[model samples]
Target: MPKGVYKLPEIKNEPIKSYAPGSPERQALKQKLVELSKGGLDVPMIIDGKEIRTGNLSDIRPPHDHQHLLGHYHQGDKTHVQMAIDAALKAKPAWEAMHWESRAAIFLKAAELIAGPYRYDFNAVTMTGQSKNAFQAEIDAVCELVDFYRFNVRNMYELYGMQPNSAPGIWNRTVWRPLEGFVFALTPFNFTSIAANLGGAPALMGNTVVWKPSKTAVYPAHLIMKVLKEAGLPDGVINLVYVGGKEAADVIFNHREFAGLHFTGSTGVFNGMWKTIAGNMDKYKSYPRIVGETGGKDYVFADVTADAKQVATALTRGAFEYQGQKCSAASRAYIPATLWDGVKKYMESDLKSIRMGVPEDFTNFVNAVIDEESFNKLAKAIDDAKKSPDAEVVMGGNCDKSKGYFIEPTVILAKKPDYITMREELFGPVLTVYIYDPEKLDETLDILDSSTDYALTGAIFSTDRVNIEKMTSRLTHTAGNFYINDKPTGAVVDQQPFGGGRASGTNDKAGSVFNLLRWVSPQTIKETFVPATDYMYPNFLED
Candidate 1:
């Protein structure tokens, strides 16, 4: 072990490269896209740093062009899940005993590799496999992930420095120890950054992890494992497995050594996992730590004093970006009746300018949804709105899956506040707007707060300071991440530590020390320099 106290390098958010026309980043990214699109990879489950391939395989096709095969991942069963868990548990002692600085170095190295050499390759995989446009891929896959690794390292250093004040004759200290067993990271398909953090955060805290990424995202996930391995992450510290959800859950939750879970996905799925963990409580050595960021019907509420163009722009970008697959995507909006026509006109103009196609085209603002299920759900919601008297399809509501799962950037104008489109989380390029009376601002705020079970993200736009203050206070519990005079999406790391409460999640904010704290179990140690002969105090003896 090193003798001297160590300080980490300064952490800063990675600068986002503008992939503009004729730019070097654009040229490099285009070349990578072409290279990745030309061939398919054979992905395998990584257990104990060894590639394990099962004959059972699943093809990974690009969402924007379903006919084009990007790769094929070997699917694992329950046996592989067991193997992964065993690997994690077996590696726990050595990993947890390793010096904190060494662990930090590996993660920081991973971030540097992604930022320098692997940047374009990571962005290209995300764009093609996940159907994200170039800019979205940069923000989510490269910049945000790089930020997560660097900032998380800084957060860990600061967390370790937090020691208790020592008494006169006694020394008191707290050791932030990793949990007794292994962590299970169940990642989502939406953000490559989120998937990396889900597994990386726990492993960084000195815990071994069994990481199971989403099946749809195995393409980029394979790359993540490669980066980790190349960055000198030890074998069995994080075992990446491609197993079915049910099989993995059964093996993980029922295990005696299962210590924690780091997850990001739908609320319903999270609830089910919580139930299973609770049911298996008697079988485990300790209560499992459950940290998840789940679903959101995120909203934008524009006051009468708010600018129509700004609100329109917020809706267009927040709702249509990434085909509205974000948990914090703007799915619903409450617009004042007085500003309805202006907002409507501006939104119409903006939607008209957007071009939808594959992510390979630099100019296309939109791409296909993730798969057939999402496309069909959005199509049904649009058709239902067309038939409903309470709702009107105001903007784009076209769906065409003949070529790919393409759904137009749709806007539904709701006559009633409780319209079906207004309440449900149709995770697609669909935005529903409800116009409310400006005079009844308090009542409108109440409607917006109670419309959905989610409390993830929301925005309130207003030029009036008093109105902004009123709305902020009135809807305090309505959203975990609240925006003022801005759109509800695009939360940055360190700047905006994201997560939510209620049905959304446990509110253990990711990208901060709060989330890292969940992965550790601190033990307080107190040592007295002087010894006492008697067990009784002085007061008791005198009395």
Candidate 2:
């Protein structure tokens, strides 16, 4: 080991590229998008640093242009999942024993690669595959992923430096050890950054991981594997596979070497997985660390004193960005009747001005939702709202799937606060607004708090400091990532350590030392300077 205490690179958030027309990034990314749209890739299961092809191919299509074939990803079964587990276990011995700084260097290099040569490629893939517009892809696939890597490296260093106090005759030390077995990373489709970090965080802590990205997100997921490998990540450190959820879980949860699960997805799935892990507790070598950020019915609340136009802008971006597929997207709102008309007028104008189509069109503010299932769900919710006496379609209630799974940025106004659209998590470009009596502010806040099971992300808008303070206190636990006078989405790494409680997730805030700490099992070592030869004390003899 090197005797000198090593210092990491000065950490900073990666600057987001504007991708303005005629700019170099924009032109390069547009070219890359064209290339990828015709690439026709054959994605395979990556186990032990080798691509394993079973020949069971599933079509990969862009959400915005479903008919156009992007590629095909080979689907794996139980056997492939088993192979992944075996590969991860095989790699664990050498990986955990390697010097920690060596591991950090790989991710640091990955960050650099993402920020430089790979930036356009990543953003392009995200755009075509996931239907994120140029700016959205820029923030998510490139900027946020880079931030996760660089900030996590810094966090890992800070984590290792945390030590216990030493006495005059003894030295106390804490050794942060990787979990005894492999971590299973179940990543979501919405954010490529999340998919990378779900697997990267554990592996950075010296644990091997079996990564299973969402089927809808395989394009960027494959790219992430390529980036990590080029950055010198050893074979089997993180295995990427595509298989049915039940099939993967049956193999993973039943295994003795399953040490942890890093997940981002639905509340129902996380609950089921937790149940399965608990039922199989006796079979595991160590208790698995279950970390997940699940569903969110994220909200935006405006007080009587708030700016109507500002709230409208926040709603426009927060609710419809990424087609409202984000875990932190604003899905519901509680607007006071005093400002509801102005808010509604501004929102209508904003929604009218917004354009929705393929991500290739930079002028389009919104793109398609993930797939047909999501489209159907969102469509039904809009239809239900239109038919209901308690609600009315405020604006943009259209759903079109002729070429792709597209749903216009829909906003539903609920006469009653507890309408289904206001309560349930409709994960699409649909925002439900419930107008409340300004005099009954406390009652409205209560309804907002109790209406949803989620406590993921929310925002409060108020110019009055007294109401601001009151609203903050009242809705304290309603959102884990709460905001003031801003949209509830776009959580930057290290700046806003993100996660939530309630049905949302285990609030092990990612993008910080707290999330990294979950991956490690520490051992405290206390060494005494002198050995005691006698068992009896001096007072025993004197007495």
Q: List runs of model 1 lying over 4 Å from the truth.
A: none
Extract clashing residue pairs from model 1.
none
TM-score, predicted candidate 2 vs. hidden true structure? 0.99
Model 1: how far residue 99 lies from native, Å: 0.6
lDDT of 1 by residue, 1-543 (tens): 448788678899999999999999999999999999986689998999899999898999998899887778999999998999899988889889988888999999999999999999999999998999999999999989999999999999989989999979999999999998899999999999999999999999999999999888987888998999999899999998998899999899999999999999999999999999999999999989999999999999988999999999999999999999998999999999999899999999998899999999999999999999888888999999999989999898899998889999999999999998788788889999999999989998998888889999999999999999999999999889999988899999999999988889999989899999999999999999997888987788653
lDDT of model number 2: 0.94
User: Which stretches in model 2 have alpha-carbon errors above 4 Å?
Assistant: none
lDDT values for all models:
0.92, 0.94
Which is the leading candidate under lDDT? 2
- What is candidate 2's CA lDDT for residue 122? 94
